[model samples]
Target: MSTRPLRVVVVGGGIGGLCLAQGLHAAGIDVAVFERDTAPDARLQGYRLNIEPVGSRALHDCLPAHLWHILVATAGDPGPGMGVFTERIRLLMREDAPPAGRDPSEQTHAVSRVTLRRLLLAGLDDVVHFGEEFTGYRQNADGTVTALFADGTSATGDLLVGADGANSRVRRQLLPHARRSPVPGVGIGGKLRLGDGAAWLPEELVSTKNMFLPKHDFLFTAVFRRRETNAATVERVGDQLRAAGLDPDLLVQDAKDDDYVMWAYVAHRRALPADLPADLPDVPAGGRGRRLRELVAARLTDWHPGLRELIARTPADTIERFDFATAERVKPWPTTNVTVLGDAIHSMPPVGGLGGNAALYDADALRRALIAVGRGEHDLLPAVAAYERAMLNNGFAAVRAATMYLRLATLPSRTVRTVARTFFRLCGVLPPLRRAIFSD
Candidate 1:
């Protein structure tokens, strides 16, 4: 291996890029991050993340101890008891499910995305050039790649990684002939503030998060307790409600200034009727709040009144929408010089919570690959190829699995939906069996 420290340029500073940068930096490699955003705090990072053991362990194995501590402090524990539910019965899928194996405490965490981002961002000592949007790139015959940003800035590195996210400009520039991933579905989410001692449902339901998989649709809801930092951020959420068509002033008055709130994500397959004409390429907007409410009402009408109550309380301005679509696979990963990670490489359905875990794994695995290359056991290009092989293999499997789960959740037939729910419920009850299917 060359004694020279390789200079790496990572596009996109989200989970994968940031984590990889952190891991690479820890290895004493020269790395820099380019973020398209004008600033890190320009927009509030949305919602929570539940990184299961596999994903969590990957992070632990890669990130520094202090960063991990910060993540844990900001994290919320969702006992294994928090699970997939269709009405009252917990739906189970997987062959390893065993009787009495479903324990809420054994599960992972519910960490706010902002907290995770902060943890990763804090560990970076290298300058992450912001407002540097990636426009294109060209590779030299010497195997070096030059990346061009829209702001007329440029960087040449041993390798270029397209961690830029779903609409990756680097990915486009690399394979101009490849079909850009079409928007497959729309995702809408919002946080709802309710009465402190609100009468909603059983304590078990309110104490932990819940998933509502109705015959017509699916909804993921998390009850966010009021926190000091989030409280200030939520103040403006009221204005968003008004913009969405709900009375912003009325919404603020309905809940105490200090009451905890519920955050909900409502998704519709793009193949379905365009619920909102105006959300965005892959996220939600306040203007589509009313449309989202209608979708929720129509789908979960038969499940629980509590859901309806929450939806009813949502302000029109608070709703946001986005489309969810990703690349089928990425090729030509760098082994000696560069590699790709996170949503930059494989974008999957969030149903199985694989996105974060897979990203962490990429960081861990790529680091190992780089280390192997350093040991002279494998050439850089070959090592990069190996990483691509493994990641894509895993990516295909995850994308296919998540897409199936999504279809099952939004299945049209009551019988099919019931069967799907029952299958997952059975898996939940049977630990070994559920382990076979759901355990990564």
Candidate 2:
């Protein structure tokens, strides 16, 4: 170790980046985050997040205790169970949350994406820099790295991290061969405000997330009920954070205006129209949303009327359309003082709740490796290499798993679809199989 303490520069202040900052700050390490967004709520896509065991562990390990309390306090009610249903709302199989495990980290948290972003940004006022565009990075003769910005400014540190999202500029400089390929599917998601709720909705729809299998696609829906409204939850949590002398105003916007029923419709590429504008990459989300809504609304006529109404009822602006893309596995590269994490390194199709969770895992894993270096257990460069190796293994595995789940959901094979339906039918009967496959 040198006489100077280790310092890290993180680009993109997303969940993964902030989580790493939190962990390093807690461990008494020097770190700074450069973010392009003007503020925490600059991009408020009020989508709900199902933080599984892995993600739960990451947040718990990274966030300060008081903020963690806020996390628990604000988390929506867990789905607790999942029910696989046919296109017409007939239950085929069900899987409950895993039986209590020895690992206390085996808990689940359902919160809004916006809410979690705010939760992660707590107490990092001095550490996080906003509106800083990271153009690229450079290595010095002394082995330190410097990140350049759009304003002709730069920040140098012992190590630089690219926690930026899918279109990471860092990855481009490091591994030009690595590419993010669009997964062969299209999806649209929305949150439906449940004012007094829909009368035709069944108890199963409210109690658990339901996967509806149409002829050649999947419709996943879940009910979200935060203990309080988004404003109230933030106000209550904000009060506690202020009392603790923290950044009370960090969480600016409501996670959602009210409790809602969330839904996502995914279609197999094989079923897509040859001239489908749905796959056009340049269209804005609102336009793509209108196109996707027409397509989904047509396909979902065979599903429950209540579900149809819910999708139709989703406000136009709140409708979101995104193409699934997975980043190519990062091949073995020479280790330096620079590295990448999260969607910056491994972008996955949206499935299995793995994308964000896997990124959180990356932050924690990298934090642990740095912790080892801080303790003099490993040399800095070698420690970063070892962490990269493990990160690639775990992160790409998550990408593959998420991709496989997406394929299974949207596979157009008649025989495969039959097998899938039959398998779900069996899961309805076989207790051990149900426990094995859907352990979550």
Candidate 3:
């Protein structure tokens, strides 16, 4: 067995990095997660995450029993599965019902990214270091990796895992040739509060998650009931804040009722005319909620009235644009003492909704590999090599599939859209056809 303690340095304190730290801690390994954000509430946590079985399992396997309970308690109700529809609200395919032989355990769960991260941060008081932006890493002559942070500080560790998301700095140092090309699409998303007397949206449409696939564009909407933030939960989080030396009043705002409808509008990059005013009003960064609504309305003029109304009624400050990009196929590198997971390795478009789940799976696999190496059951390089091979093979395949779906949804030619609409309509009515079309 290796005499030195396995000190793992994880860059990026997102889901993948946090989960890996949790798992390593559970396995009695020393791990430290360095995140760029200054604090827990430094930035917007973004929208909800649809965690499938793979991601849920990663959490379950990594988190302690109590933390897992908190996660499930705080998550939104897993209503029915996703519903596919047309711009006119016509149902094309309902995937709520699982396939005949699918396992119940494979169902998806909806979770708020903020709440999930907070829950994962529980009991990890000393492990996660926030506000430390990762700059790069250097290999030491004594078989160790030293991670450099923007703060002019550094930490040496047995291994470094880059989970810094799509635009990872660690990945740049590791594979400078790796490419991250922008997928030719613009994604605008917003949230609408659907509380008392706010029944503008049809119940059926908001009752379950729906995806409206119109010609040359795509839209997805899901209504999630926010988990009640009870006094106990707030108190717990407050304690965590104090432990981290942050002000407890950071969360002093009264919690709002948990009823909101979130929706996203996606279109081809060329959908909007090139001559659109470049100097069109500018909203402060992170303050583009209203501008996002206006942008959506302007770009989706030909959409259905109901769909357009949703965007119109949405509060301006609640809307924002999502930065979308796809990762290039990364060539394998020597697994020496550095590696990467999640978006740092393979990032795909959101059309397939596979990126998060794949990241979870990667964390789990990498955790197991590191554990093996720690136990002296396998050499470090070989174990990491095996994990990378499997991850790249599956990850890139998912990327290709998502790219195909994105193209299909954003077809430039009208004839292609017509044929796709016809085929989807047929699939909506025919069970066999639906199964075949959606079959894994």
Among residues 3 or more apart in sequence or in different chains, the pairs in candidate 2 whose N, CA or C atoms overlap within 3 Å are: none
* lDDT for each candidate structure: 0.62, 0.81, 0.76
Show model 2 residue runs off by greater than 4 Å.
100-104, 228-239, 244-256, 273-291
| Error in Å for residue 16 of model 1 | 0.6
Candidate 1 residues 86-119, lDDT tens each?
A: 6533444323322354332233666666556655
Q: Against the true structure, what is every candidate's RMSD?
A: 7.8, 2.9, 3.9
Q: Candidate 2's residue-wise lDDT over 39-134, tens digit each?
A: 867866756778888888888888887877787777776576778888778878988666765353567777777667776776788999998999
Q: What tens-digit string does per-residue lDDT give for candidate 3 at 1-440?
A: 56666789999888888889988998988899999998875643577787877788888888776666556655665466677777878877776365455443355667777667776676788998888989889999988999999889998898899999999998899999999898877777777876675667776456778878777688888877645554555566555455544443433222432457888887777875443222226645435566567777886688778788888988766676664689999887877889999999899888657898888888888889888888878777788899899889878987998888777766687788777777777877887988776654
Q: Which lDDT value does model 3 have at 313? A: 87
> TM-score, each model?
0.79, 0.91, 0.87
Better of 2 and 3 by TM-score: 2
Residue 140 shift from truth in candidate 1, angstroms? 2.5
Indicate the residue-level lDDT of 352 in model 3: 55
State the local distance difference test value for candidate 1: 0.62
Best by TM-score: 2
